[model samples]
Target: MKLTLTIWRQKGPDSKGKFVSYPMDNVNPEMSMLECLDVLNESLAERGEEPVAFEHDCREGICGSCGFMISGVAHGPQPATTVCQLTMRHFKDGEELVLEPWRSRAFPFVKDLVVDRRAFDRIIESGGYISVSTGNAPDGNAIPVGKEESDRAMDAAACIGCGACVAACPNGSAALFTGAKIAHLGILPQGQPERDRRAVRMVAQMHEEGFGSCTNIGECTGVCPKEIPLEVIARMNRDYLGGAWRERKNVVTTIAPVSDWDFAKK
Candidate 1:
């Protein structure tokens, strides 16, 4: 198959970007999207032209490092699959494909289709860790977790932090990604001690990162490669509200006078 590609190219974060067109011919329909890019890079190198810079670690979609918008759709037209997993067969001959980086204030363009997603890392660092020791590996049976709980945890943990959710959201919200992290730990017994605090801190960090609020448009779930359900956002909302209530109660208690405290104590 043959197609035309209009790829965004930027020398650096401060450089102006523009779409440069290239004609791709003799592309194998069976080739993965990354393979097609490899072919393009080779041709560009052969012509002494600079090649397009894109991110791809595993090239198997496990790493979530390979991500870009194809024809305005995150990770191409396929559902629940990353760009590296996307194949040329999904496109028709002579089609023009437009490739660009994930656009959002939080995700600044680094070069071409690569964007700096360190904001996500910061958000995770805010409260994504468990306060458990790692001195030695514990026995699996020691936790006594139920199978259903384990399955739910695995489902939430499937999030690969690809930033597609933010890209697809019209408001550029990272609610899905944040919610997945919160849900994954919230379902586990070890996460109980910090559950409310985790929710509050993560949400605060998400807002501080300049990510937009969720409006329930559902685009995040629609373009997620992992197919993380929109319900995760709902769960996150519940946790956030509960967290807020606890915070407010704590504040009131801290501010209460001795007489009020004694009356309440009675």
Candidate 2:
């Protein structure tokens, strides 16, 4: 199969980007998208031309390192599939695929099909883990978590932080990603001690990172490679509200004093 790839190209974060098209004459239907790119890169190297830049590691789709808009769809048109796992057979001969990087303020452009996702790392650092240290690894049956709770936690834990949720959202919201991180830990018994504080801090950090608010449009989950559920966002909101209310007194004390109290009498 033959295909044309119109890819976004930029030398650096501040450089001007443009679409550059490359026609492939020998595309194998069995080849994954990344593998096809590798073939293209080999050809480009042979001709002494610069190859297209994209992220990929462990092309099996577990790394979350490979992603970009393919023909305007995050991770191509396949549902719950990453770009590296998308086979060329999905497209027809003479088809043109347009590729672009994630376009969110929180995810600054790095180069062609690459963006800095460190903002996600910052949100995780805020309170995504249990700081308490257990002396040794416990037995599997020690915690005795309910089957339902464990299932939901595992569902939320599948989020790979690939930034596809933000890319697909019109509002550029990171709610889905943040919610998944919060829910996975919040549902677990090990996370019980810092549950309230974790929600408050992670949500606060998300806002500070310049991500948009969740309007419940549901775009985030629709394009998620892992199909992370929309309920995670609701869970995040519930926890944040509960935590904020509990921390209200401490929150108020941190605010600066009001100097014009007498004006109310007028």
For all candidates in order, the CA lDDT equals 0.86, 0.87
Q: Write the per-residue lDDT of candidate 1 for residues 44-74, one digit (tens) a residue.
A: 9999988899999998778889899999999
lDDT of 1 at 52: 92
Error of 1 at 259 (Å): 50
lDDT of 2 by residue, 1-266 (tens): 99999999988765679999999999999999999989999999999988888989889888899999999889999899999999999999999999899998778777788887888888888888897656987677988899999999999999999999999998889999999999999998988888888888888888877889899989888889999999999999999999988864533111111222122223
TM-score of each: 0.91, 0.92
Residue 216, candidate 1: alpha-carbon lDDT: 94
Q: What's the CA error at residue 71 for candidate 1, in Å?
A: 0.3
Mark the regions of model 2 whose C-alpha exceeds 4 Å error after superposition: 248-266
Say which candidate scores most in TM-score.
Answer: 2
lDDT of the structure predicted as candidate 1: 0.86
